[model samples]
Target chain A: MIKLNSNLMIHQYFCLMIRYLKKQNFWFVFTPYFWLVLFFFIPLALIFKISISVSEWGMPPYRDLFSLSEEGFKIDSTLSNYLFIFSDPFYIRSYLNSLSLAFTSTILCLVIGYPIAFYVAKSHANIRIILLVLLIIPFWTSFLLRVYAWKVLLQGSGIINSILIHLGFITEPISMLHNHYAVILGVVYTYLPFMILPLYGYLVKFDLNLIDAANDLGAKPVNTFLKVILPLSLPGIIAGSMLVFIPVVGEFVIPEMLGGSDKLYFGKIIWDEFFVNRDWPVASALAMSGIVILVFPIVIFQLMYAKYNFKNE
Target chain B: MQNTILRMNKLFFKIFTLTIGFSFLYFPILTLIAYSFNDNKRVMVWKGFSFRWYKELFQNEQILEAFYTSIKIASLSATFATIMGVMIGFSLTRISKIPARPFFIFLSSSPLVMPEIILGLSLLLFFISSNHIIGFPSSKGQLTVLISHITFSVAFVAVIIQSRLSSYDKNIEEAAQDLGTIPNMIFWKITAPVILPSIISGWLLAFTLSLDDLVVASFTTGPGANTLPIVVFSKVRLGLSPEVNALSAIIMLIVVLAAISVYFINRSHIKK
Candidate 1:
C-alpha cells in the first residue's frame, strides 16, 4: 500500500511538469537556443577576444588578453596585427585579387548559366522535371571530384592538350595547369549550378504568353529580352550572384589546387599566416576584418530592407 | 520566305546554346571517368583501358577508412541537426511567444552568409579555449569535427523545415481539436504526419553538407579522423592519382543513380 501511494505521487508530479512545459512552449525554444548560444555566439565572441590579443610563442600561440601581473590585474593587447594587414601591400593586394576573382567568376557564371536556365525552363513541361533533376544530380556529386576533374583536363598532357596537338593547333604541350585563367575556369565550372538553379526557380514560373504578347506588340527579340525577360529575371540574377560572390571571395581549394604562385589569394594568405607562419593574431585579425569588409555590409543591407518592408506594410 | 528564315534561325539558336552549355559541364566529367580505367600508373598518359585503378583503391586502407568515417560522422551530425531544426521550425511557426525571438532568428540565419574559413577558425579557437578552462574535449578529433558540422548544418535544415512548416495547412490541427482530440494527441497524430516528409528532406540535406565539408573538418580534425574529402584533397593537390579518378567515377555513378531513383519516387508521389 505504501509503495503504490508513492508511485501515484511521482506520476502526478511528472504530469504537472509536462503541463507547465506545454503552457510555456519551453522545449521548442530552449533546445535550439541553448545549442546556438554555446556553439555559435560564444565562439564568435571568443574570436573577437583573440583577435585583439598579442601574439606570443607559447603552446597556444597568443598572449592572454587578461592576465595577473605583479602590479595587479592587467590587460595585454595590440593593434599591430590589424595595422600590419592594412599597411602591407602584399595583404591588401591579395584581398583585391580575391575580390576581382569573385567578380569575374560571378559574371562568367551569369552569362553562361542564364541561357541554359531559360532554355530548360522553356522546355516542354512534361520533360522539365527530368531536366531539372539532371541539372541537380551533378551538383550533388562530390564538389572536390568535379574540381579534380578539371585538374586532369588542364594538365600539360591532359585531354585538351592531346586534342589540340592532334589537331595541329600547337607544336608543343603548352603549360596550362596552374594559372589565374585555370582557377577562373574551375570556379565557373563548379559554381555554374549555383547560378542556374535560382534562375530556373524564377524562370520556370514565368508565363510564356508574355513573350508572345511582346512579340505580337512588335517588340523585337533583342528588345523583348532586354525589356521583358532580363528585367523580370533581375532578382534571380542578383540572388545567384550573391550566392557565388560571397563564398568565392574566400575560396581556398580551387586557388590552392589550380592557381600558380604568380599571385596570392586572400584565403591562401590567411591560411599561410596560421599554419605556415604560426601567427594566430594575424589570422584572427584577418578573419575579423573579413567579417567587417565582406559579411557585415550585406547583413546591414538585409536589415534595412526588412525594416523598409515592415514600415511600408 | 523571310518568316521561314527567321523561324529557322530561332531553332538553330536554341539548339546551339544548349549544346555548348551542356558540353562545357559534361566534357570534364566524361574525361575524368574515361581516365579512371587506364592501365598506366602515370595519369597524363593513356596506355590502355583496364580495371587496375579500381583494384588498387580496394587495397588502399586509408581511403576506405576515411570513407567509412565520413559516413558515420555525417549520419550522426545530420540526425542531431535535424532534431534541433525541427524544434526551431515548430516553435517559430506554431508558437508566438518565444523569448528573445529576434536573437534566435539572427543566430540561425547568420551562419548562412558567414564564410567557411572564418567559421572554421572561430570554432577551433573556441574549442581550444573551452578545453583550457573547462578541461573537456581533451583533444580535437571526430567529436570536434562532428560538433562543427552540426553547428553549420543546423542553419540549413532549420531554413528548410521553417519554410515547410509555414506553408502547411494549420486548419487540420484546428479541426482535430474541434473534434475533441486533445492538443497533445492532435500534434502527434496530425502535425507530425504532415511534417514528416520535410523532416526527412532536412535530414538528407544536412547529411550532404556534412559529408562535403572539407575546410571546417580540416580545422577540427586531429590524428585519427581524416575525412574522405581531406584524403582525396591531399592526394589531388600534389598532382593526379589514378586511384582517386577511380573513386570519383564510382561516386559519380552512385550519385546519379540515387538522384534518378529519388526523381521517380517523387514523380509517383505527385501522381498519387
Candidate 2:
C-alpha cells in the first residue's frame, strides 16, 4: 500500500512537469518564431510578390502588385519576368553552367576528399586530433583570402608560371588566372574541408574490424571496399555532397574572382540582373525559379526520407 | 611474406594520401604567409624579407576601421544569435507541444540550405522595403548588417544546440523537477551547464560566419559600414595588395592559435 502511494505521487509529479512544460512552450517558441516569420519567411514571400510585379521606371523599380489606379482595382501582375528568364538562352545557359559546375566540383571534392578523410580517420589516435585541428584551421580562415591565394599563385608573372617555365613544361607563361579550370580548382580547394569533415565523422566511427572480417572471408580489397566500406559510408557521402553541392550551385565569389567572360553562372546572372541591369522583377523571378528548382525537390526528398525512416522504425 | 608486402603497400598509400592532402590544404596558406614578408611592392617577386607591409597595414586607416567594424558586428551578432538559437533549440527538443512545429523547423533549417546570394538579395530587399514603409533605419549601415548576420546565424547555432540538447541525458532535469525545484531554476542548474560547450562553439561559429561574410555584407552595407572583407576585396579586386597579405598572415596566425588552444582545452577537459 505504501509503494503504490509513492508510485502515485511520482506519476502526479511527472504530470505536473509535462503540463508546466506545455504551457511554457509558447513563451520559448514565440520570440524566434516571430523573428523568423518577420525576417525570413516574409522576405521570401516579398521576393515572390516582386517577381510577379510589372517592371516600371521608378524608385522601387517595379510597379506595386495591387495598384489603386482608375482601372477599378486591377492587379498589375505579370508572369513575363519568369517568361523572360525562360525565353532567353543566356539565362538558361547560365543555369546549366551552375548545375554542371556544382556537379563537377562535388565529384572532384569527393574523389580528392575521400582518401584524405579515410587516411585521417585511419590514423593513430594521437595524430587524428591534430589532423582534425589542421583541417579546421583553413576552414575558419577568411574564404576570400583563400580564393585570393589562388589568384596570386595563378598570375601571369606568378610562381606557378615561373615554375612551369623553369621546368620547361611550357615555353611561355600560360594564362591560368581567369578560366573555368581555375574556378573549378578554387571551388574544390575551398569546399574540400566541408566534404572531408562529414566523411571523417562517419568514417571515424566505422568499424575497421569489418575490413578484416571481409578479408578473412576471402574478399579481395576492391570487393571489400565496394561491398562493405562504400555501402556503410553512403550517409556520410550524401551529407558531404549536400554540403558541397548546394552552395556551389549559387557560388558567386569564387567564380567572380577566378572565372573569365567565357562562362556565366546562375549566381553571377542574378547578381547582374539586380545590380547591373537594376531589374528587380527579373532578379526576383530568377531567385524564385532557383528556389523552385533547387529547394523544393530537396524538401520533398527530405520529407519522403523521413516518412520512409518512420515506417521502418 | 605476402602479408608483409601488403602491409607495406597499405602504409605507403596512407602516407602518400596524407601528404598530398595536407600539402594541397596548406600550400597556398603557407605561400601567402611566406610572401607577407616580401620587401617589394609586388607580392610575388623575390626580395629581402622585411616587415614593410605589416608596418604599412598598421598605418592604413580604411582597413583598420573596417577591421574594427567587422569585429564589433561579429561579436554582437554572435551573442544575440546564440541566445535566440538556444531558445529555438530548447523549444524544439525539450518542449514537445510547439504549435506549427513543422513550419518552425522549416524556418530554422531552411537558411542552412539557402544560397548566400539569394539570402543576401532577399534580406537587402526586405530592409529596403521596410525602411521605405516605416521611415525608420533611415539609412543602411552596421545595424542592417547585424540583423542579416543574426538572421542566418541563428539557424546554424540552433542546429548545434539542438543536436547537443538531444544527445544529452534528460534525467537530471526530471530529477530536479521531482525534487520540487521550479522550472527556470531547474533549467539554469541542470540543463545549461550540460550544453555550455555547445553554446560556446555555436557563438564561435556564428562569429566566424559574420567575419568571413562578403556577399551578404556587400548587398546590405551602405557607406561607413564597410567590413574587413569589403576592404580586402576592393584592394585586391584589380590586383594583389601586399598589405592585405600582411592582414591574412595576422588573421591566419590568430585562427591557428585559437584552434590549438581549443584543442588543448578539450583535451584537458577529457582528462579531468
Candidate 3:
C-alpha cells in the first residue's frame, strides 16, 4: 500500500511540473506573438491590402485626382498612383518642402538644444530637476492650442505686429503668419523638447576630463568644442535629428494652421487626399513613398552608427 | 586683449544659446498662457481681464464630454499597455532559451520609428477588415480607440520596463528559488517588488502618451466619440480663444505638479 501511494505521488508531481512548463512555454512563445499579430502586423498588412486592392465603387473620388487624362478612371495598381505623385510638380514640390523644413528644424533644434542639455547635465541636482520640469511643462498642453497661440502672435493685426507698430520698428506687420518661416518656427518650437531630452541623455554621462585635457593641450575653446565635444556628442545629435525629422515629415496640423491655405506640404496634401478628397489610394501611395524615402537613409545611418562606437567619449 | 576677446566670445555664446533655447521652448507656451487671460473673445485682440471664457468652457457640454472620454480611454489603455509591456519585458529578460529574441525586440521597436499617419491609416484599415470577417468588434467606438492607444503605448512601456530589467540584479530571484520557493512565489515576492517602481513609471508614461495623442486618435476615433486633442484642434482651426488657452494652462499645471510630486517622492525614497 505504501509503494502504490508513493507511485501516485510521483505521477502527480510530474503532472504539476509539466503544467508549469506548459504555462511558461505559453507565455514565452504564444502571448507576445498573439499581441504583435493583433496589434502590429495585422494592421500593417491591412494597410497594404487596402492600398493595393481595386475599389468596388466606381473610381473612388481620390482616383481621379492628379489625372491628366480627365476621364476620372481608377487604376488598381500601385504604380499609377505613384506615377501621379511623381509626375505632378505640386506633389513633388511638397515633398521637397517637407524635407527642407525637417532638415532645417532639426539643425535649429540641435543648435538650441545642446547647451540647455549641457547646462542641465552640469547643474546642481535641485536645479537640474527644476529645469527638466520646466522643459516638460510646455509639453503638457495640447499641441494644437500652442500652434494657435503662435497664429495670434504672428498674424497681421496680432500682438507682435501691434507691439512692433507701436514701437515704430516696422511700418507694417512682417507677414509672419501663413508663411514658410512660420511653419518652420512652429515645427522647431513643437519638437525642441524631443531634441533636448535625447541630447540630455547623452550629455549626462559625458566625461568632462576630455574637454579639460583638450584645453590643457593648448586647443582654443572653439577648437576644443569642435574637436572634442561635437564628435563625442554625435550619437545624441543623430538620435535627436531622427526624433525631430521623422515626426516633422508627417506633421499636418502645424502647417495647416500656421502655413495658411497657400503653403503646400506633403502632410497637408496627404490629409487633404485622405479626408477631403477621400482618395485612399493616392494617400497610401504618398505615405508609402514617404516610408521608402525615409527608411533607406535611416537604415544607412543605423548601420554606420552601429559600426562605430560614439559612446566611448 | 586676448583674454578679453575670449571672455566676450564665451559670454556671447552663452547668451545666444540661452536665448534660442528659451524662445524655442517657452515662447509659444507663455504666449498661450498670456492670451488665455486676455479677456478678449477675439484671439488677435487683447481687451481686458475676465474669467468668463473659463466659465463658458466649463459649460460647453461637448468639451466636457470629450475630456471625460479622453481620461477614460487613457486610464484603461495605460493599464492594459503596462501589463503587456511587463509581459514582453519579462519574456525578453527572463527567458534566455526563447528563440528570435532580437527579432521580437526589433518588431516591437519598429512602431516607434514609423510615422503616426501611417500607423493610424494602417490600423483603421485593419479594423475595417477584421470587423467584416470576424464579426467581432461589431462597431467601432471607445473600444477601437483604446485598442489603438494600447498598441502604441505597449511598445513604449516595454522599452521602459526592458531597460529597467536589464539593470536589475538576478541574484535575488536565484536566492529565493534556492530557498525552496516556487517560481510563482519568487516572482510575486521578489521580482514584483524590485520592478514595481518601473511598472508604475511605465504606466504613468503610457497614460501621458495616450492623453497627449492627437493623430492616432483622429484616425481610430469613431463617429460621436471625440478626444480632447481633436476637439481642441478643431476649435483652434476655426479660431483661438482664451477658453482654449485656459484649458491648456490647466493641463500644463496638472502635468507639472504631478511630475514634480513624482520626482520628490522618488528622491525621498532614494534618500531613505
Candidate 4:
C-alpha cells in the first residue's frame, strides 16, 4: 500500500511539471484557440445548422422555407429558392440595379476621395490636421440621421428644390426625391469618408522623392502623377473599394427611403421575404447566395493582395 | 513659363476637386441644420427664424423614449463589448503560442466584413433556435439587442485593443511577475494603465456604432423597444418633419463637442 501511494504521488508530480511547462510556452496560444472556438466558431456553426435545418425542422414559423410547398416536408431537397431568385424578373432586376448603384457610387467616391487625400497629405502640417478634422466631423453624426436629412433636402418640397426655385434655376420644382439619383447620391455621401481615410493612410507614407525623380527625368506633371503616384496608391484604392462596395451591395435604408417604390434592390427583397412574407427558408437561401457571390471576389482580392504586399508598396 | 502654367493647371484641378467634394459632403448636413431654424409649418418652406421645432422635439414623448432607449443600449453594449474585447485582445497578444491565431483573427473580423442585414438575420435565426432548444433567450428584447450589439461591437473593440497592444512593451509585465506580483494584479496595475486610452476609444466606438445602427436594431427589437434611429427612420418614411431636423442638429452638436474633447485629451496625453 505504501509503494502504491508513492507511485500515485510520483504521477501527480509529473502532471504538475507538464502543466507548468505548458503554462510557460503554450498558454497564450491555447487560450485564444479556446476563445475563438467558444465565441466565434460555435455561433457560426449554429448559423450554418439553422440555415440547413430550416426545411427539416420546421423552424421560423413557416416550414419548407426552401421549397414551393407550404407544408413542411423531409422528402426531398430542392434548389427552387435559388432558381426562383434567378428566374423571377423582379429579383434579377433588383440585383442588377443594386450592383450598378454600388459600382457607380464606388467610382464616384474614388474620384472625390483620392484628390482630397492627396491634398491633405501634401499640405502643411497644421493645415493637414485641420482638414482631417473637417473630414471627420461629419462622420461623428448619426449615419442614419444624416441619410434621413438627405431625404428632406431631396424631396420636392425640401430645401434643395426650394432653393433652386428661388434662385430661378428651375421654373418648377424637379422631382428629385425617391429615385435612382437620390440613392446613388446618398451612397456616395455615406461612403466618401471610407474611401478618403484609406487613401490618406496610403498617401501619408508615400515618398515625394519618387515624384521629384520623375520630374527631373523630364516627365510632365500629369505623366509623373499617372506613373508614380497612381501606382503607389493602388492598394488604397482596392481597400477603399472593398470597404465601400461590400456594404453598398446590401444597403436597404438608402434605397428604401430614396429609391422610392419605383425601384427595388436586393436588400429590400430579402427584407420582404423574411418580414413581410414570413419566408425564412427563402430569405436564408438568398443570404447564402449573396455570401457565395461576395466571398469569391473578396477571396480573389485577398490572394492578389497577399501575393503583392500592396499596402507596403 | 511652362512650369508656371503647369502649376496653375494643377491649382485649378485642386480647387475644382475641393469645391465639388466639400459641397457634396456638407450640403445635406448644412441644409438639415439651416432648416431646423426655419419658422415654417411646411418643412421645406422658410418663413422666418424660430426655435419652435426644437421645442416640439423636446415635447414629443415617443422621441424622448427613443433617445433614452438608444442611450441605455449604447452604454450597456459598449461596456460589455469593451470587456470582452480586452479579454480577446489580451489572449491574442500575450497568449502567443495558441494554435490557429490567424484563423481566429479572420473569424473575429468576418463579422465586420459581413453585411449588417445578413448578420442581423443570422443572429435572429440563431436566437430563435436557442430559445426553442435550450429554453434560453426567452424573447428577443432589450437583452437580445444588447447581446447582438455586443457580438459585433466586441470585434471592433478587439481590433482596436489588439492594435494598441502590439505597440505595448512586454517587459513591464515580466518585471512585475519577476517581483512575485500576481498575474491579475500585474494586468490591472501595469497593463491596464498603458492600454486605457485604447479601452476608452474602443468603448466610444462601440457606443457610437450601437447608437447609429438601424438595420440590426430593426431585426432584433421587439415592440416598445424603439431606438432613436428607428424612430427617426419610421418618421422619415412617413414624411419629412422639422422636428427630425432639430433632433439631428442636436445629435450632431453633441457628437462634435465630444469629438473635440477627445481630440484635445489625446493631444495633451501625447504631449505628456
**Which candidate gets the maximum lDDT versus the true structure?**
2
Which pairs of residues have clashing backbones in candidate 4? A28-B95, A29-B97, A29-B98
Q: Per lDDT, what order, best first? A: 2, 1, 4, 3
- Measured against the true two-chain complex, the DockQ scores of the candidates, in the order shown, are 0.45, 0.53, 0.39, 0.47
- Candidate 1 residue spans exceeding 4 A from truth: A1-22, A300-313, B1-8, B97-102
Q: Give one digit per residue, the lDDT tens place, for model 3 in A1-313.
A: 9999999989986787577567685765457557777888877765555555433344333332223456765454446677788999999999998888889999988887888888777666777777777777666556676677788778787878888999999997888888888999888888888888878877877888888899899998899989988888887888788888987888888888888656688877877877887777777778878888789656644544333321221
TM-score winner, 1 or 4:
1
Give the alpha carbon lDDT tens digit for every residue of A1-313 in model 2: 9999999989986787567656785666669868888878898999999999999999899998987867688788999999999999999999999989999999999999999999999888889999999999999999999999999999988889999999999999999988899999999999999899989988998999999999999999999999999988887787788888888989999999999999999999989999999999999999998887787545753454233222311
Interface RMSD of each: 4.4, 3.9, 5.0, 4.5
Query: What TM-score would each prediction reach against the true structure?
Result: 0.91, 0.93, 0.87, 0.86
lDDT per residue (tens digit) for residues B101-163 in model 3: 556666666666677877787777677667867976777788888988988888779877876
Off by over 4 Å in 2: A1-22, A300-313
Give model 3's TM-score versus the native structure.
0.87
Which segments of model 4 are wrong by more than 4 Å?
Answer: A1-59, A62-76, A300-313, B1-16, B168-186
Q: Report clash pairs, candidate 2.
A: none
Off by over 4 Å in 3: A1-25, A28-32, A56-78, A297-313, B1-16
Please report the candidate that would top TM-score against the real structure.
2
lDDT tens readout by residue for model 4, B1-272: 99799899978887787777778778888889988998887888889999999999999999999999999999999998888788777766776554445555565566666777777787777777778779878887888788788888887798788767866678888899999999879978988999999999999989999999999888888877898988988988767888998998898789778877887887789789
What is the C-alpha local distance difference test score of each model? 0.85, 0.89, 0.77, 0.79
Better of 1 and 2 by DockQ: 2
Error of 3 at B269 (Å): 2.4
